[model samples]
Target: MRAENTQPVDRTMDIETLMRALLRDVLGLSQDRVDAFDLDTPLFGALPELDSMAVAGLLTEMEDRFAILIEDDDIDGETFETFGTLLAFAEAKAGN
Candidate 1:
């Protein structure tokens, strides 16, 4: 397995800010709701809109926005169980 990257991003880049942006842009959630979410909150369980189609949209968004490649077999429900888990997965893919 490859080693995990731990370098920090630019000071202008905030993890929470990036996470909220991802939630809103990729998940089509309003800023209001996105802002109120806890780290452990289950995004799909909390929002009914995140079904199979939403997963496709999310994967597309990740590739476009983060330049993170997600293989077909790389993800399953467990990886998406919570907001923090999903964000961690993205952070790992981003090598950060």
Candidate 2:
């Protein structure tokens, strides 16, 4: 007989904080810049650092940090349209 190991996931982790840190680290944005982002803050086209190439790295980091899998069809322009949209996408993918 073997005992099963069980541990509850920490759902209370603040996704917004994680996102702010991620954006700062991945995109090399200043802490002040990321901290100032509101729900309506534009991302992809509005930020010079968040170009098409950076999107790939951002997606990869999101997957690793959030422990969520993102498929090719799962993303579109709307996903990165704004800070709110990106947060919504992350919350959905993380099952939050």
Candidate 3:
């Protein structure tokens, strides 16, 4: 009998994939555009699709998807600055 391989799964991929889906659905972005995003990619003012109107929807979507409550005071410009930052914030909020 061989020993079983045991390793903890990485949750980063799940968060990133979920975020891409949210971005695509909420902001109506193309799969190519969402796929092209990296950790350093700028959001907020940089993305024309992510405007004030879309921000609320995005936040709501995130809250619903992650089952996390995000207070008004919890978000700021920096929170939406990059894909990685948003993922990190969500991970923290989710206690993952």
Listed in order, each prediction's TM-score against the native is: 0.77, 0.86, 0.88
- Which 10-residue window in model 1 sums to the lowest lDDT? 7-16
Residues 1-96 of candidate 3 have per-residue lDDT tens digits of 998867437777878889999999999999999999999999998999999999999999999998899999999878999988988898888788
- Model 1 accuracy (lDDT, Cα): 0.77
For model 3, the superposed segments whose C-alpha errors exceed 4 Å read 1-8
Residue-by-residue lDDT tens digits, candidate 2, 1-96? 998767445543478888889999999999999999999999989999999889999999999999999999999989999998998899889888
- Compute the lDDT of residue 46 as modeled in candidate 1: 66
The Cα local distance difference test for each model comes to 0.77, 0.90, 0.90
List model 1 lDDT by residue over 46-93, tens digit each.
678787788788788877777778998889777778878887777777
User: What is the Å distance of residue 56 in model 3 from its true position?
Assistant: 0.3
What residue pairs clash in candidate 1, if any at all? none
The residue pairs in collision within model 3 are none
Superposed Cα deviation of residue 53, candidate 2 (Å): 0.9
- After superposition on all C-alphas, the RMSD of every candidate to the true structure, in Å, is 6.5, 3.9, 3.0
